[model samples]
Target: MDLPVQQFRSEVEQGMLDSFAALQEALPGAQNEKVAKLRAKAIERYGSLGLPHRRIEAWKYTDLRNRLGEAFPMVRPSGGPIEQSEIEKALGPRIANMDAYRVVIAEGEFRSELSDVQALKKAGAELRSLAETLEHLPDDLEPLLAETGEQRSGFEAARPTGRSGAGPDPIIALNMALMSGGAVLRLGDGISLDKPVHVIHLDGSGEPVGSVTRLIVITGKGASLNLIESYAGLGGRGLQRNALTQLVAGADSHIEHTKIQREEDEAFHLSNWLLTLHENVRYDGFQYTNGGDLARNDVRVFFEGEGAVMNFSAASMLKDRQHSDTTMVVEHLVPHCTSRELYKAVLDDESRGVFQAKVIVARDAQKTDGKQMGQALLLSEGAEFDTKPELEIFADDVVCGHGATSGQIDDDLLFYLEARGIPEPQARALLVQAFVGEALEQIDHEPLRDALTGVTADWLGVKLD
Candidate 1:
């Protein structure tokens, strides 16, 4: 629980604890029972184990205590109607043709004009605001919501420790404590979405604000859906966005989830994505983080049945003094499951990048195939990248391996491109793209991939001829 000796203990950590203590007192007994229970449990855990510091193996590379040394004021939920232009401006040009509607949350409040509730209704999809949905969540979904921090039943074979209790995470606790608005999306059985649904979280130039948003997605058997999430902060200093997404994919269903973060240079961002895949289900994810003072994305995926497949890829373009971390855990619980993960980071100026990936195959999960790779390009003298890729396979018949590489741009490729009359900046940009293009190729949608390419080009400050 003690912070690294180099840095002073976090006062913000204390502030968060105090805030939770106050909230437990202010909230009525029946009104906030669930959250109160979670907070109480978390506090007890914090008292016993404290926050997992950099000493913890799982948090060695990116020291969260250093990032959250202080606390900002919590964002209140009183706001005017949300605007569509705000979403457009934040999304910039990453958005392609979206037949699926959108849900916009501005400073922790839902914006109607930015969402397409009517369209979802017409398609037999259920789209409800978190406030209303939580009041009447279906009985079947209640157990799913329970933060059993413990591993899922099917995944128990992967981690023999049998540690499956979901305790309070400071970051998650911060989100639950301050959450004011969010979205709930559900797809009916056999329904296929014609377009990808986009959710935009935007912050404005106001008092330093702290906000939390939650999203829950459920897919029925044989259904398919594509979901895109974009996060942005407009001219803000010291703003924080803590977001969480929990997805449950049904049998024979397919889901593609993409997250794009381009917040202001001074803002802070933290996000967690937890996904559970059933038999014959497929899950694909692409995450892109381009701007932030301190940003971290944590992803956890579980394979619960036979023939399930999961693929996750990420591309990060960091510059200046920015700091970004991508941490993921993938577990194969059943036989015949497959997973592949590839992450690439491009660092320039004095920025830093972190990638930590772990893949686990259970003893009984024979024929499981899992592969992981993390590669990085340091474009400037001060840029840096740290990677940790690991595989713990208990199954004797499983195929599992992982590798990591970090180095500067390939001089030979740069020279070859320059020899072709490509200028230095353009040549470097092209080579960097070539290095990461393989991951982009995994994207099924051409337009979206092209949009991401454009974003990369812009990040490199090069205009393709």
Candidate 2:
């Protein structure tokens, strides 16, 4: 007689354990000995650590253990390439009109037929599918895939405390075991992408299915590029999405990036972005959300050299018991670097919003300048907002500050708008837009900014002629 398998405490854990066994046996990467070992290590670490919960300070507000109930197995491509009609139905009205070089990921597979890979290559950029690369990973991939810290950045050692695998994040660990395909964009030295590259993820399989999509973007010295990502779930039940984006800015490069999410009302969306910047680099990034029952965005940034600058911003519109969390960590390891972050949210009904940020300055990282702020507008008495801002400084010469605030809509502003012939609903919409627009304006790209503005209009029910 065989002993029975141990039971987990919750449905989510049991599902994860069940899915890991299935993915390890069926996924293509299992055939490769090196990749197989990596996957096994990741799963083992995840098992030991379990789901990030309120007990951990970093994940305190967004309790994955209590909230998630899906086992969300890895998706495999069963049908043919996604058709144009399907893409249209999935993306909705706002992102469809944007002029961008589109890359499509459907049913956990990269759809080359629907992508503009050829145009990107012609413009001196390199693109590849992660699944293809996994079959024959290059030896030099380690340097491109190094951990996220510098010589003096706090927590310079490898992550997960003491895990051995392709990465430290538990979600990324599960992804390593079952990820089907993703996108990779690399720009060589002095190469500049003229048009923005847009990555679109469509989840509309009409059933409960979850998949991991990974995107790696690297810019060589003196290079410049703009990248955008959109995640949408349509006509589906029990849809879960996990995405990981890795960004490396080479010396003297400029990178502008933004992420927009508009998934199904009951879908589960989780994303993580790891960014590393070198000497004299400038990074501008943003995130805007309009959908999801449970959504969390985690971002981490590390400065590798001097004279680097970063401007990070995010905004969310939530209602009807929705939960949205934005978590970020910034590490300064070099001298003369500056980073600024602003987050805003508008909550209605009984929705909840969370903003958690931590900035660490090392003893050797002198002359570092960092500031962070979180602000939220409560549109209803039942809405809830939580914020945590922290700064850890070991250097005597660095300057860092953080602040957070949540309050109801201003009466004076509402009255002023209604007095100017604007109806009560319209006046509320205008005020909400103005409140979130402060952070949206940080993105310098005009067209992208305007496109996001259009999304805000839709959220506010504003009519655009």
List the pairs of residues colliding in candidate 1: 148-166, 149-164, 149-165, 149-166, 150-164, 150-165, 150-166, 151-164
Query: Which structure among the candidates has the greatest lDDT?
Result: 2
Candidate 2: worst-modelled 10 consecutive residues by lDDT: 159-168
Model 2 clashing residue pairs (backbone): none
lDDT of each structure? 0.75, 0.80
Candidate 1 per-residue lDDT over residues 287-398, each given as its tens digit: 9999789888988888887999988999999988898989887878789999999999989899999998888787788999999999998989999898888777778998
Q: Could you give me the TM-score of model 2 versus the true structure?
A: 0.93
Cand. 1 Cα-lDDT: 0.75
**Could you give candidate 2's per-residue lDDT for residues 1-465 as a string of tens digits?**
122233455778768768878767666556777777777766675675566677666677788888887676667676575666666677655566578888887776788888898998999998888777767876655444333222235353554441311124666656665566787888999998887898988776566777777788889999998898888865757767778888989999999999988888878888888898999999999999878889989888888889999999999999899999998878887889999999999999999999988888878889999999999999999999999998878899988999999999899999998998988888888888889999899888788888788778887786633
Residue 330 C-alpha lDDT in model 1: 83
Top-TM-score structure, candidate number: 2
Question: Model 2, residue 355: displacement in angstroms?
Answer: 0.4
